[model samples]
Target: MAWRKLDKMIRPASCRAGCWRCVYGCPYGAKWTARDFIIEACRDGAHLADRARVLRVLVENGRAAGVEVEVQGKVHAVRAPVVVLAAGGLGSPRLLHASGLGPRCSPFFSDPVVAVMGSVDDIDGGAEVPMAAGLSLHEEGIALADLTLPQPMYAAFAAQVGRVDRLFAHKRTLSMMVKIRDEIGGGVGPRWADKTLADSDRKKLAHGVGMAKAILREAGAHHIFKSWHFAAHPGGSVRIGEGVDADLQTSTPGLYVCDASVIPEPWGLPPTLTLLCLGKRLGSSLAATRRAEGAA
Candidate 1:
């Protein structure tokens, strides 16, 4: 089992009991978000059109020209030599379809998760950080982790499973999550996306839940139950090789993708680091290409 901590970003002393600002928005700036990167980019001369919605990518003569954007009920075109699509897995596929680049996204995966909860006589689990420790059963396509939800969220989950009686036991509840690598079998269109779990996926989740229950029992937990299945980190819609090339470039030249949409396979784990690496690599490659053109 491996334990992850955000000690570098969050100061332990700053954390308040029952304060789950981390789940919503952190006022302390202890949580690094995409906003931080946006601020850095703006400081470095990048233009940000706040509240702008990209209508479609403009392609001319087999190359990307720019994009049409809608801002404050006004539409305008922004021209550029290179267009990078980082709208994420769901949004990227939708944009591609709107741009007439792809008819639709192929099957995709959304890591399905369920939280197993039980009552404990000691230890206030709700006060702890969620997903702090976990291990992956790669062959079984399952991952287990300690998950501590905020009281309200916990109550909601408890209520989901008709366990309203257990809602008040949030403070004494111990929770763990079972996340499964679901089979990729969903289609994404310009306006909609849907997914259904395969029998194999359900079996994997059931096995994981059984294991979690055993572990909770070992820890002296009682009144064990599970939350309904929920999904996180949807991806694999616009896959590499099928929708984009290894360089993340689409069929139209000068247009590239750098997001979860380009991930080619089912991913059951957190993708933050993988996405960061892909973004860095894409940025470097684009910068190098620009320098070459400048020199030429």
Candidate 2:
């Protein structure tokens, strides 16, 4: 095989594969995180209170006035003329309900994932970052992300291999993760989320795994393995048109929502970029609203 040719295809910029640092953090300062935004906001006169968790919105005269938050084992009320709920899908709906809004939020879905694993002789799967290369089977509702998990992470997934010695061959072990677009049939409750895998979603996941396995085998991999099922990126519990308006304003005046909960449907992609774009748009609108109110 052509090692040089494969390297050009698989390598992603500056990322050394099989490093679990992305989980704890990126020490290289390559990854952008919310901390960066919070720091910039603080520099621009935004006040931040660490370890504060909001309990509910405080509504008066059918309008949002403030929020009740818990901090340091004590609950306190903070009053504001305009309140925004940036909590994610789960927390946002729960907060809306706790504030005496509708108890039922719009149904949501999650990215149901299953991974396929195999081994290839003389091929170091960990030579490059996981998911450096991918193929989108859009019509099939499946996407593949190349994976080469670190030893500990790989061992956890390959538990059925059942031998420490065999699990040590991390370099040769290759895997691909299948992220399928699941159905929206789950509700966000006050304290919990109730969701079940629909038959259609199950079929999609199975098909995605089958596609991944075929790719791995064609690349000289053998002794394929399949990991346990999992779900990620719970979203769409609230919607743009149904839960909030285009301006991100909810039915309650002065209350706004700007998060993944506002996504109208399953995007089959990571929501980080989407949320960042939404946040910027919401910030601009809020600034404009404040300016208008001040002029009035």
Candidate 3:
């Protein structure tokens, strides 16, 4: 109601509560995005690494043999009876394709995000809880957030030193943004030719940006700006029904995927919760089955 009220308050404008439209387009500084959850997964015992990249999923004789990962230009093969692909939609598809899962096994992917930016006063943008506020506008199936950014990312976002100068010139005038889950229109393609953002998506972004700006203004923000933000969060490749069954185990038995890439809907907020929840569910289910077999 606060967001709706604020959106109404902005009149012809929309504002979300602590929707964090105060910051947008920042990856690391976004604070507590899915990245936080991934970190938690690591803390909770999921192995993660810096600069580690997966090269391919190895399949041998119709089974998930293992995987080959590249670290520092060296390929290391991690042989496992089971393999899981938790990479985002794009990553998953690319991996599956490389491994011959191809279009047949991987399908159903979505990209949902409308990026909007705002500039505020002396906020030290990246210094706070990292866009910790949000409100769900019932009419719109989405949430909002304000975020902070480092100089490097800001520079890229601004696209040049002049924009960066404008940002820092009025240092107190901090920058913020909102990311609305776009309608069913926006998505990722094999390339630019495939990547398309529809008019409805634009409208949603307009709505999202309008709301963020209004919230920032209400919060005492003086300056604001908005740009297009496509959903960086990719998911659905290796869809549940295709490469993996309902249990999240792929056709290549023993293979599993425990990440947001498999989620089937717009999360509205960060997906870490769903991913973690799914992970727990899958793990427990597998553990129980293993125990039953072992006892038998």
Backbone collisions counted per model: 0, 0, 15
Model 1 misplaced regions, further than 4 Å:
1-19
Quickly count the clashes in candidate 1.
Answer: 0
lDDT (CA) for every model shown? Answer: 0.86, 0.78, 0.59
- Alpha-carbon RMSD, each predicted model: 2.1, 4.0, 7.6
C-alpha RMSD of candidate 1: 2.1
Off by over 4 Å in 3: 1-52, 71-77, 104-126, 160-165, 183-194
Q: Which runs in model 2 stand beyond 4 Å of their true positions?
A: 1-20, 104-106, 125-127, 160-166
Q: Write the per-residue lDDT of candidate 1 for residues 229-286, one digit (tens) a residue.
A: 9878888987899889999999899999889989898889788778998999999999
As a TM-score, model 2 comes out at 0.88
Report how far residue 220 has shifted in candidate 1, in Å: 1.8
Model 3 per-residue lDDT tens digits across residues 19-102: 333345333343334566688779889787668888878888888899989999999998877687877666776676667765
Which is the winner by TM-score between candidate 1 and candidate 2?
A: 1
Ranking by lDDT: 1, 2, 3
TM-score of each: 0.92, 0.88, 0.71
Top-lDDT candidate index: 1
- lDDT per residue for candidate 2 within 1-296, as digits (tens), equals 11111122212455554565654456666556778889999999999989999999999998888999999999999999899998897889888888887565557887777878888898755544555567676676777887667677778777754545447667788888889888888788877777788999889888888888888889888878888777668888878888898888999999998888888877567678789899999999889988998999
Record all residue pairs in model 2 with backbone atoms less than 3 Å apart, i.e. clashing: none
Model 2: C-alpha RMSD to truth? 4.0
Q: Judging by TM-score against the true structure, name the best candidate.
A: 1
